[model samples]
Target: MSDQLQNLDLPYFAIFLTFFLAVLSSLLVLAPTQRGISATWDYLKQVKFIERNGIVVSTYIVIAVSLWVVVMIVAPQFFMVELSFHDGTVAADVNYDYSQTPYTFNNYSYVIFGSGSDDSYFNVLHLKVFLRTIIASVCITLLAFVLCYPIAYYMAQTAKGGTVRLLLICLVLPFWVNEILRAFAFRILFGSSGVINSVLIGSGIMDEPFDFIKADIAMYAGLSYAYILLMIFPIYNAIESLDHNQIEAARDLGSSWSRIHYRVVMPYAKPGIASGCTMVFMLTAGALAAPQILGGPSSLWFTQIITNWFNLGDWTRGSAYAFLFLLSCIVFVLTVMKYFKVNLGELAK
Candidate 1:
């Protein structure tokens, strides 16, 4: 096998060593942790706590959880992580024959430092686009939160039965259309010669049309609108179960509306706020269609970079980019949880 290996770049020995190291690391890190968790779960089962709490705690449930973790999270991410560590150009065959080549961290290095011109701990171009995506996504989350919170509050606390149902229908109606179609609709509406521009021209408000897409205002608006429901429903669900009498008591005690929300409502809705923000931020960060359709020429989303890498037949690079993007999202989620002081366990509720 070594004689058949004619490559030095992605050496077979390196691959074997890397694979060995990865397996060793996994065992070293995961063995005790997994053992502890398994022991704890077993203890819980022995005590009948899980079953007493309405959980089945059955073999089928255990199998399902194992299968979900292995299939949904472990297997895919393991392959991607492996791919991200490989040097595709060196020993990779036409079909990514990595037999002769070992995995390398060059893919990550390339994306992070960009050929080492200025190895100042950052790849300027990639970092710029990444930060732009993060900032824009954060802005979209905040805008959606601000825009939907009041509406959700009204629907949950103030609206009559008929009005609440009607508002919910209105909220969900737009989602009946596909997300891609909605993005395209925004494209036409924000185009230079589209509805808004035509209206301005016809009304004599302006002789010229404004280019929303070119200015990237359309991108921002589209992203906010794209994930607006994600921001609304979580908040609505959280607020709906609140005791209305507390609000009434606050009102009777001369608490203003803003005060009522700030002191009472928002504190109760932290979990929903965290959940909504996490969803909106992640969706906007990973959005492809809305940015592709409504973003300006200069507006570059980081996901597009990953897409381009895959299109260019570079799965290793694409996987590296994806992992980095995923890391950023995880970091953002953690930051949100920390800031809002919401437990991950609470997000599901």
Candidate 2:
């Protein structure tokens, strides 16, 4: 048995086995409850709980607090931090070492303030990437919302099942193909000397093919295509749940189409807009592949900073970048929540 266990290849097998055994032992201890012997004791315990809902809730709180204590006190010290060396000479291997660690803010200072002769703590390239990420995310979200809003409204207002189903199928059909393949297909279409240019030039629209690759226009177009469905589905569901009677009542009171939409429909669709914007923002901010392939060397985004850090074996700096990105996202979310006057609980509803 020991030899067999030693030969086991599964990394988490021991942990799973321990949990299984603990559960099995618990079941065994509770087995007497299945018989009449422990029935009276169980009933007594249940009756004692009637006067102590507060006590039950308090017990849960205490257990949760204890679990957190264990995690905070025991986990961090035991877990080792892995480091990698990649000087571009040999195969980089992870090493666990903290022997010469200093009890100061040296690492943070070095990352933030830079080393001698470098003269800067933060990388300017990274700053550029971060700004580009924000710009790209905002552009994608706005473009997607503009393109999807009308389609979603139409889908919601339409009553015919066949038409709605067909529209939905058309909306989602692109997803049937793999995302990378779709991106590459866009790349092909929008590349210099591609179909659009060929047709335009052949029709005497221009003398030369337009340079579509690595342009901001191409990046926005590609990202908008990728994320339009995300924006559409949420807004469609939100608008579908709206009461049509309200719109009819507004119309009866002589409200114009624009007035009805602005006053009645827009407020209800806020939650969906919030959700879709959040999704698009996060996805586009962290996007690496699309920018790399379509936008090429000219376009830089924050995720590329993460990639550079990882490739250079700078885990601490990479973690810092991730946390900074998270902080920015949280701030944006909070701002939106405040502006909309909607809490997370309301949005969830």
RMSD of each: 4.9, 12.2
Tell me which residue pairs clash in candidate 1. 10-101, 15-102
How many clashing residue pairs appear in each of the predictions shown?
A: 2, 3
TM-score of 2: 0.69
Q: Identify the runs in model 2 with alpha carbons over 4 angstroms from their true place.
A: 1-122
lDDT of 2 by residue, 277-304 (tens): 7777778777777776678657776777
Tens-digit lDDT track for model 1 on 88-173?
77746678655455557778778878867674757888889999999989888999999999999999999999999998899899
**TM-score leader:** 1
> Candidate 1 lDDT (Cα, whole model)?
0.82
Q: Candidate 2 clash total?
A: 3
Error of 2 at 60 (Å): 18
